[model samples]
Target: MTNRYRSVFDIIGPIMIGPSSSHTAGAVAIGHVANRLFHAPIKEVVVRYFESFAQTHRGHGTDYAIISGVLGFDPADRRVPLAVDLARRQGLKITFIEDQGLSPIGHPNTAAVTLINAEKEITVWGCSVGGGTIEIRKVDLNGLIFTPQGPLPILFVEANQPIGAALDQLFGENYRRPRVTHQLADHYIYQLDLLDRPFPEQIDQARGMSQDLTLL
Candidate 1:
């Protein structure tokens, strides 16, 4: 794993409701980030747990925590305990699968969540690396890897055409250079870790650059 911890808070953990930070809070963080990356109203969700997460999810509230995060709830949200009921009431279908046979090369607290809607589907693979921290390893069938660090805003842009130059010009000098992943010959995903919250106009500019852009 890359050295993702940047501050004392990363070591100390986040302010969240938890029985175990790794299983509960970290799970929520992963789900929340996945939801953000999906950037669409989810109609269905399928979560596959691996190894440790597969064995201890129910007991550790990992299931509920993940559901809560998928519903766009933060770790400290009061509705976490009732995430299942809430999801049902909101017409969201959810399923859980325990795949203990998966390869154990990565973190033990790992899960792959698939979010589905009418137009598109997105799969996010993430791991809770303790202390309420998480690392998103993959998105869809591509190697889109990243870790959300503090207030740094992450913008995901997916497009069929080449928009890197436009993005470079739009964020020129003001933001950190983006990490780009080529998922297909003509399709790309740009992950930009911004120094500050982008202005509404800037976001609109990005959206205009590519109809597929989704700002987090």
Candidate 2:
């Protein structure tokens, strides 16, 4: 089950820092993605750790990693605990649980996370592989895996319409300052009107749809 063109890096790389890559790095990635998918300030979060993550998570700072991620901090930062404190000080309610039965399929460090905000709730299931690399296995309690990171259909127009020098030719004038926000991936979450456009030409839309992007 390996693709020839997929680099070793694809299998083995995710930049992060931690007590343990699986517990710390993976947990952080999960929290970060959940926060983004929700696309709003998370007022409350509950993380349920499983298997190895539950057993050795505390020693590896999994709790702090998840809390920091919910607060928008990267997993590579040494100040993850500080971020947790900052969230608490900012009145974010974060809770943790250790549950072993969530992932009967695979992955030893699986976790189910539920996030709450003023108007919505999001649940994500994820697993942390070694070396801080993480895969967001599912979202919205769907059981189907979906990862928010990387490219997908929601990004087609932005990819085709590059915001900088490329767009200068089409807009009828040279613009020194780039119109950046509209082109950023995160911005689209706030602009739902733009979601239906076809994806970039180079992307294999069918393949992207076939496999659940869940599980890094």
Candidate 3:
């Protein structure tokens, strides 16, 4: 799935430092999401490229695009080109592999990434759909389809209790209610897009839901 472009901002392509949208901007978005999922300093990572990505990644700035994004640098950041050095200075280890787009990926411009932090490993798969748009196909092996777009805050909650009720209790019913969906059995996914609103630091009272929750 691609991000909905409601304005002409996307029509002219994003304002970023990149040579190609599919290879650079999209790749940066993919890595940005992966970093959020990882949720900690990335100690090590394995990035496998496929099809067009494998063939032309180095030539099109895909390598730096991803590295800079994970390091929390925006695409327009002038420091994007120095991402690899920055990661190395932070003791991050990265390995790039060329593959035939394995895993459950259906998109051609794909990169299956395994991001390792001190506590856990996050597996994320992303695909570039061209024109600076990309799709986050899956995370942690559970099939998901969403795009991280807009300035609004987005949160994904995986919980054992009724998160809808928790959200209502936390933010109030009159507030922008979260959209709920089912992930694995005994688990629920909550997506809240409150324009410019900030979430609290704690959301307890639901079994480890806040622990696995992701804020993007």
Candidate 4:
């Protein structure tokens, strides 16, 4: 029930250099998505692969896929093969773990990704739903089930007075409304569905955007 509708990318799969959609494309997207949750530059990352991904990740280019994504490469990029070396050059330290635990969601392709910066840390639990589609099940240990439809801007921030005032001033436009919002601990997570277009520059730089927000 996370995704109510399907986008074109769901059926055709993403344009990716893939050994498989679940292993390669999905892993990269997972890492990219995990990175998006952090406001600071990623310094270290830890990923745990489950089931099939845990067994064949290395041979299937899954490791490269994640590293490339953490470095902000999309699935279709040709530089995916060099992501590991590139990460080291960028001062990103990555750790991989193999976990055999059963998934509550019953998906074969699943990962628990933890990303860290100088001050903040974020963890995401997700699964690949085939054809490059993914489901984010949790964030910061709180259930946050959803599936992205397009190139939407996801915002994560603390739900406080300043954040509210800042967001009100920023999203006061006539056409914009949050597609969904979730409260997690002291923070709030939401996604701005752009409906097949790029995000506007104005809202991207809105007054409160940087106060306590992470725009994915």
What is the model-wide C-alpha lDDT for candidate 2?
0.57
Clashes of each: 0, 1, 0, 0
Candidate 2 lDDT, 1-216, residue by residue in tens: 412213465356556675677788767877876776666777888888888888887788888888777777876676786776787888888888877565642678887778887677888777775666565545552222333332111221223233333333332232223222233333211111111222443234422332211111
Name the runs in model 4 displaced over 4 angstroms: 1-5, 141-216
Best by TM-score: 1
lDDT of 4: 0.68
lDDT for each residue of candidate 1 in 21-67, tens digit (9 for 90 to 100): 98999888778877877777889989999999999999999988998
Q: Flag the better candidate by lDDT, 1 or 3.
A: 1
What is each predicted model's overall lDDT from 0 to 1?
Answer: 0.76, 0.57, 0.70, 0.68
Quote the lDDT for 156 in model 4: 50
Q: Between candidates 1 and 2, name the one with more favorable TM-score.
A: 1
Against the true structure, candidate 1 has what lDDT? Answer: 0.76
Encode model 3's per-residue lDDT on 13-72: one tens digit a residue: 688987888898888888888888767767997888988899989999888888887887
- Model 1 alpha-carbon miss at residue 75, Å: 0.6
Look at candidate 2 and tell me the lDDT of residue 28. Answer: 82
Q: In what order do the candidates fall by TM-score, top score first?
A: 1, 3, 4, 2
Which regions of candidate 1 are displaced past 4 Å?
103-105, 141-154, 159-161, 166-188, 191-208, 212-216
Native RMSD of candidate 4 (Å):
5.1
TM-score per candidate, chains pooled: 0.76, 0.62, 0.71, 0.71
